[model samples]
Target: MKNLNRKNAIVMGIGLLMLSVAQIAAHYNPNMPDSYKGFFMGTGLGIMILGLIKNKPKRAS
Candidate 1:
């Protein structure tokens, strides 16, 4: 299995941190709107996806 590059690893870490922050914020404020939570969750997922993705190798003709 290939290992993640330093930049990708950092991006994943930031995404995880954002996810945790969203959860904690929601927990502390029960009245938080679903939209706000969804925004953070979605953004985190997107960031994580970017971090996990690798470039596809080009096939020689």
Candidate 2:
């Protein structure tokens, strides 16, 4: 139902995020400062939090 759809969406979002991170890493310059790493980690964490917030809660039935 709706819960299943929500879960699927979250999974898809996570998958996309992972792919994006992989692509960035592949082309990223090694000499860059650690600030870039911090930014990427922050973005990943923010996405995870967003997914958690969007998830449906279980019914009390």
Candidate 3:
């Protein structure tokens, strides 16, 4: 817990959230809407990317 910095924590959290959603989707009925599934996966990817990439801090020398 203490070892987890802000950026790492955010990324990990988002990754876990995405994973949970994917797991649920995977076990669900195939009758689900493609658009909704796509949207959830896409949004999860986008959020994960934002948390990992956009939240990175610049190195100072």
Question: Cα lDDT for residue 31, model 1?
Answer: 100
Of 2 and 3, which scores higher on TM-score? Answer: 3
Write model 3 residue lDDT over 2-58, tens digit each, in one string. 544687678767876886786598668577787767777777777776666655556
Task: Report the lDDT tens digits of candidate 2 across residue range 1-61.
Answer: 3554666577657856865784577467676666776676567667766666657676799
**Could you report the Cα RMSD, in angstroms, for every candidate shown?**
2.5, 4.5, 3.6
Q: Give the TM-score of candidate 1.
A: 0.83
How high is the lDDT of residue 22 in model 1?
93
TM-score computed on alpha carbons, candidate 3: 0.61
Residue 50 deviation, candidate 3, in Å?
0.2
Sort every candidate by TM-score, greatest first.
1, 3, 2
The superposed Cα distance between candidate 3 and the true structure at residue 60, in angstroms, equals: 4.2
Instruction: Provide the overall lDDT of each model, using Cα atoms, as 2-decimal numbers.
Output: 0.83, 0.65, 0.70
Tell me the lDDT of model 2 at 39.
71
Model 2 spans > 4 angstroms off: 1-28, 58-61
